[model samples]
Each structure stands twice: as structure tokens, then as C-alpha cells.
Target: MIYDVYTALPTTSVKEVLGTFEKNKIGGVPVVDGKGILVGMVTDGDIVRFLSLQEKVYFTFSMAYVGETEPIEKVLKQRMNTPISEIMVKKNLKTLSTDDTMESALSLLSKHHFKKLPVVNGVGRVVGIISRGDVINRLAKMTSDSLTIS
Candidate 1:
């Protein structure tokens, strides 16, 4: 579990979220409220899905033209100011508690194919983050220690 977790606020702008992703070299972050309670999650996939260009088709006399409603640059600039809350996954989010064991975290990550899970306290405030990599590393260390000759 990573105690030093990167997080975003509900009102954080899409541009800011992207900056955080780039700066920290991370793929996703848990969105927290002002009180530090987990509200949602924002991921690179979510932003890409939200920013996908919409196809526009125009039909003329015996002709058709297919194009995007707006230019990609225009869409990007416009969406940069949008709040993360608009695109964050707010419903049916999976999370972990501090009391959860490594087996539980690994089970959740592998079963659901999640890269990371937010660890929260009794009040739902984010305390840390556990990723698949973290679990795998710990397991490897334990195995190596067990195999080591005295």
C-alpha cells in the first residue's frame, strides 16, 4: 500500500488532472471531496472516452459527407476547463479498507482487472492506494525470503 497517494478534488479541472497524471506518471487518481472523503475516480481512459470525437454525417443530393462535429483541438481546449466531476466514475466504485489483507487487495485487483484500489478509513476518507504492482512486489519479497537458505 502506498501511503503517499496522489489525489484530486471534485472541482479539479480536467487540465489540472492531466497535469497531475503527467507530473506523477500515474494513470488514475481517486477524487476526494473537500473533507477528504472519496467521491469518485478519474482515469486516463475516462478522459479519452469523454474527449472522443463525435462523428457527423451530412447527406446531400446523392452524396454524403462524413466529418467530426468539431475539430479535435477545439474540443480539447473546451474540455480542459471542464470539472473532473463531470467525467469521473461516481457510481459503483470499488474500494478497499485499511483493515483489508493483501489477499483481499490482490483478489479485488485481479478479479476486477483494476490497476489500483483506494484505501479508505472508517469515515470513507482516503488513506492510501494499493496497486497490483505493489501486491506483486510484496509477494515476490515474501517468496524470496522463504526460499533463502539460513
Candidate 2:
């Protein structure tokens, strides 16, 4: 678990960030500053929300019709290509310690429905990432042990 974490620096761009995430097939990334202190988190939802107003794809629902069709240039003008530091969620970072139990980690995951949780050391530097997939995979492994028992 300690070795399973993925991290991204705040300097990472939206495109590069998404690329790294796609390469790793992860849903989210922790946005850390230069010193590796946890600053904020970025998820796929945030990106979708950011770009949602620009392009009008095929409408899947009635709500899509309600969305304003702003010009791409106008939208871009209003858009703040701010760094992760400016946009990432500052509060409610569900973090875990390196030595914390998996049960505790699972509890945090289930409660917040977070895709990734930062694993930090005593100084609060991120050392790992515990994702929901990681939890599910671990649960599957534990279940396998019980499957053989009874």
C-alpha cells in the first residue's frame, strides 16, 4: 500500500496532468506544492465541470438544453486557467498515515466517496495514494482468503 500511491506536483498542467492520470489509469490526483505539502486534490469531475460550458455535444438529457451556448472564445475569456493551487479543494482532505490500518482507510473512502486519498508521513508529505480501486482490490484479496476457509 505504501508503494501504491501516485502523486502530481502543482505545476502539472491540465493536459499533462490528465495524460499522466490516463497513463496510470487513475481517477484523481493530489495537488502538492513544491515542498510536497498537500495543497489540494483534482478529480475528473472538476475537469468536466471546468470544460462543461464551452462545447455542446449531443444532448443526453433535457437539462442539456437548458445549458447556455456561450461562444468558445467568450468562454475561454472568462475561464481562469489558474493553477491547481487556485482551484483545487482546500478543505476536507481525507488523508491517511502510512501506518494507518486498511480498515481506517476504507472507512474514509466509503464515507467520502473519494477516489484517492493522500498517504502522508509524520511531516505531512505525501508518500502514497490509496484509491478506491486499491481498496476494492484489497477487499477482493481478503475475500479470497475467506472463500477458501468455508
Per-residue lDDT tens digits for candidate 1, residues 77-112, read 888999999999999999999899988998999998
Work out how many backbone clashes candidate 2 has. 1
lDDT per model, in order?
0.93, 0.75
Error at 57, model 2, angstroms: 21
The positional error of residue 100 in candidate 1, measured at the CA in angstroms, is: 0.3
Q: What is candidate 2's lDDT per residue for 1-150, written digit by digit as tens? A: 646656667766666666767898876788887888888888878766775665455566564444558876666556545455555677878899989999999999889877778898898888888878888999998998788643
* Candidate 1 residue pairs in clash (backbone atoms < 3 Å): none
Candidate 2, residue 107: lDDT: 95
Per candidate, the number of residue pairs that clash is 0, 1
In model 1, where do residues sit more than 4 Å from their true spots?
Answer: 57-66, 148-150
The top-ranked prediction according to lDDT is: 1
